[model samples]
Target: MVDSTQRIRVGIGGWTFEPWRDNFFPAGLPHTQELHFASRAVTAIEVNGTYYSTQSPKSFARWRDETPDDFVFSLKANRFATNRRVLAEAGDSIQRFVESGLSELGQKLGPLVWQFAPTKQFDPVDFGAFLELLPKAVDGLALRHVLDVRHASFMVPAYLALARRYGCATVFADSDKFPSFADVTGDFVYARLMQSQPDCATGYEAETLARWADVARDWARGATPAGAPLVEPAHDSGAARDVFVYFINGAKERAPAAAQALIARLRTG
Candidate 1:
């Protein structure tokens, strides 16, 4: 999806799901070709593997070469960086994660998502320090960060203000288990929709997919989607902003289908 200035991207969490080998990936498609095929199918993909372990610079370069020119990958930061009891002391871990060859992805890198556990409450001071530790750039390439805060305590004006101050995006998680809300706090919008169903052929019906397409468009134009749950007052800067919508944490098997369906709707408009 596009306007003259900004872009709207749709994707799934990762490319190597075994179920997708039969469901999303073509029959007999080589496992090694999954990224090649997936990169073509969706405009973006969240690199979930980065959350578990650090990848080599060669691996990042290979991923960059595997995808299309316009494709982008949003990486989930290492669990050790964000899953700590003390956020202020995570500077070293944060540095390690950013220094772990992410710059090799170059233009193909989208955003680095620092996801926190549900148990981590909103300690304004601690959270602020964590956000501060995120470097603005690495190896001359600009870095974009997205905070994935799951605790309900983060649903406050202070949290939004902090995020806006640092210009980091906050996740708009669409999950029943998390505090799912939409608040625009940065230069881009990052959403993780997690309600896809295994029964629906396309994960979501035409109506839902169409609605998401509309929401994504609104975000691209720098408007918060009307009727979206927001913790802070909606502000329209009227500046074009890139939007990333990933079908993540749902019935994982249907994420690819959901992403493809949303992409189809986005393309038609």
Candidate 2:
């Protein structure tokens, strides 16, 4: 059971994958019930569709109602909000995205991920200005933001510092395709593990999942796990934190298995 105010959630990128119907979803399970079933298996999910387009409030509400009470859904912001040639001009787009019924998910809403293009390099003044444009609240509800900066240039400490200053979390992405930065920048930690291989039965070997579970727990207890890449000094306040870890697109077909394996490891411990 999770303690109040402290949670370690492990989940996949999204619940609506066709591959999951064969592996994760029960045989003959209805497509409409995928979210219902996936939520019961994992504590959280990252909503990827929102990154490409805006969804109706009814859709968000349905998702919230379909999931378990403790389940959470982190949404990726639309590309227009983060992909413009001039990011600062994205204010209106961001506002529209937020006002488009995100609050309908209520407490089920997790952090909003702002993923920049891989080609987007780190520019202190420009990036700082864009971060400042992020709203702290949406429809009277507090918002938690996570920056998924893919360029290797964003590995600098200044990027993390800017994120910390805005109380935004920087994605601790685990992938060789993109730079991995494990710095903890906010009250919570968000990680995206994208190295799972299709040939592996469970996406990740048991030993790897167990190791990640250990790291998840360490993060929950406000400690930076040993061996994690760090751009800033580590510190512990002795208070537990909420940690969200997602097995994202690597061997996309195996993501659900990887997430489920990690969840089982954490629960068993």
Candidate 3:
């Protein structure tokens, strides 16, 4: 069980575009090398590639070895499980994807993020059923399930309640299309700041990072500000109460700079 009242774990998205590669890692470094470099600064990573395809066991084994033991990898469940038009029909596919990853990632598996497409609307019955099925799917594995629903219709109080009931973390995405942190729910928070405009997206302003850091710190200590709902107790201690903030707003050239800045802020404070 994760201790919520402890230091917050900060990290960036796993895939970095070409332009920002040089700044974060030496030019022409291999993908694994880049991952190692990022791990040195940040303790967690959002594995975006799993959304496209399942990784082979051999590949996953190599990834586990490349990073330090304290590092955590948050995997995005494959698209077939998340982007489906018919939710119930995805059971087999979802099971297969989860099983494949679990075989390789073992204990290194962090949270399994299910990011539903924006076009999909919320169907309470279907969504609830889906959430109920998840715990059984990853039965023995010790990992957290995170929901990143993007539609405006899905941001209601009922939806958040369902997320908490199933013990899944609701992602707090800072995007124009989705609701912000004020309304999200969960014991563990996953924040992804996807950039829309060139100015705010390319790199985080000093104030922006500082503001987020403060929130992350407060959440870690189990002290929600007035009006914020108290987070449910998920673990014996609060050490695992992590704040995963990724900067997806930066241009390909600026992601490393933005990630580095955030990492520095978390460490210094």
Worst window of 10 by summed lDDT in candidate 1: 1-10
Model 3 lDDT per residue over 83-144, tens place: 88777677787787777755466667778899899898989888887886685445466667
| Local distance difference test, each candidate | 0.90, 0.87, 0.70
Q: State which candidate has the highest TM-score.
A: 1
Model 3 off-target regions past 4 Å?
1-6, 136-139, 196-202, 225-240, 250-252
The candidate, 1 or 2, that scores higher on TM-score is 1
Residue 30 Cα positional deviation in candidate 3, in Å, after optimal superposition? 4.0
Q: How high is the lDDT of residue 139 in model 1?
A: 100
**Residue range 41-113, candidate 2, lDDT tens digits:** 8888999899998899999999989998888999999999999788878889988889999999999999999
How big is the positional error of residue 46 in model 3, measured in Å on the Cα after superposition?
1.0
Per-model TM-score, in order, reads 0.97, 0.95, 0.85
**How does model 1 score by TM-score?**
0.97
Query: Per-residue CA lDDT of candidate 1, range 5-112, in tens?
Result: 239889998899998987889999999999999999989999989999989999999999999988999999999999998998999989999999989989999999
For candidate 3, the per-residue lDDT at 265 reads 77
